[model samples]
Target: MAEEQEGSDAGSEEVLLTPAQLIRSLEQAWMNEKFAPELLESKSEVVECVVEQLEHMEENLKRAKGGDLKVSIHRMEVERIRYVLSSYLRCRLRKIEKFFPHVLEKEKTRAEGDPSILSPEEFAFAKEYMANTETHFRNVALKHMPPNLQKVDLLKAVTKPNLDSFVFLRVKERQENILVEPETDEQREYVIDLDEDSQHLIRYKTIAPLVASGAVQLI
Candidate 1:
């Protein structure tokens, strides 16, 4: 069929940064950003790679402009690439937002506890970028949005009375000398164990520091 030949012809032409490659690139970017928290003074190399390939893809798209089917197919593929990029950045943004306090205090803090991980340079960049991003989210993304849609930025969302609930947590790090609520005046108890999970009737504020320090996680 003529359509089949057209498809074959288009497929024969080399395309830049296929969807799989783009997805992989984004994943690598996320990993680098996460694991190399101390070296984060540099922008993500993965993001740079993706943007370069994206530009190449855009050029190809321009060349394929006359072919409706080719353009359509390429558009769909491009959308996929954009989605991966957006999802990667948003995920990073969410983590950064959640740990904004840690970022402020320590350049490289663990997901659970107070020991620092980021170098001075990485911390400065992260803190500045996060502050700007949060401002943008507040001023643009969440500003004047519908009431129901307003809670999309969960990090900045105001707590509702019904929103509080009992949670299960798994301990992942040790916190020394933490004061426990009950058992009267013993004052300091090594309250948690590594890899031990427990359920508690508590508020977010009660465990927020633990969660921030990578000492505990909701399970």
Candidate 2:
């Protein structure tokens, strides 16, 4: 009976996550700001604040700026974090349902179900976690970007006949996302917006007005 009880306990356990581990993961994901040596040291503390805000249901991200220290918080990252968290929540709910399927059935009968019971604060926490993940991915991309972009015709730059062969040209001066436009059958133009993700120079294009403007540069 004791062995059976121990086995059951192991089967029903939830994995435990340490505060330190959580903080490290979160810090790695939301790191988009420049800092002095002293400031960089304080990231652990700032991450703690984020963790608390999430635990208590608060939205605490600062609006990113474009300049000396460029940081682009992609919306897609936020969505990815939310997606992973939502899946985790569903898995937990499924486990709960297995033990108490009646509760889910009853929830379905109600106007709003158990899933609806999650607080806004909880959702915010999930976003925080995702933001951390995004920041980490961006940092990894930056280290590998090419120093120079060559033979990259303004026309071919945006149209990018070969997506796989295309290189990402980051605009350190502007701190923005690249805007691509197709001017005519012969040419394409691309503009880098300083407010988008700084780590990757996205390959894309727009049509027409680009040719008329004419001015282009590699930065």
- After superposing candidate 2, which stretches have Cα over 4 Å from the reference? 1-20, 23-60, 66-71, 74-76, 101-219
Task: Summarize candidate 1's per-residue lDDT along 1-219 as a digit string, tens digits.
Answer: 001111124355433555456556465444434432222222344455677677778889887757598789888888878776776566556555555554454443335533343434445656787667767777896778886765454334422222233445555564455443433475543353333454454444445566544466554
Top TM-score: which candidate number?
A: 1
Deviation from native of the Cα of residue 22 in model 2, angstroms: 0.6
Q: Report the Cα lDDT for residue 20, model 2.
A: 46
* Candidate 1 ranges with C-alpha deviation above 4 Å: 1-22, 27-43, 104-126, 129-219
**In candidate 1, how many clashes are counted?**
8
Error of 1 at 169 (Å): 19
- Tell me the deviation in Å of residue 130 in model 2: 33
lDDT of each: 0.52, 0.33
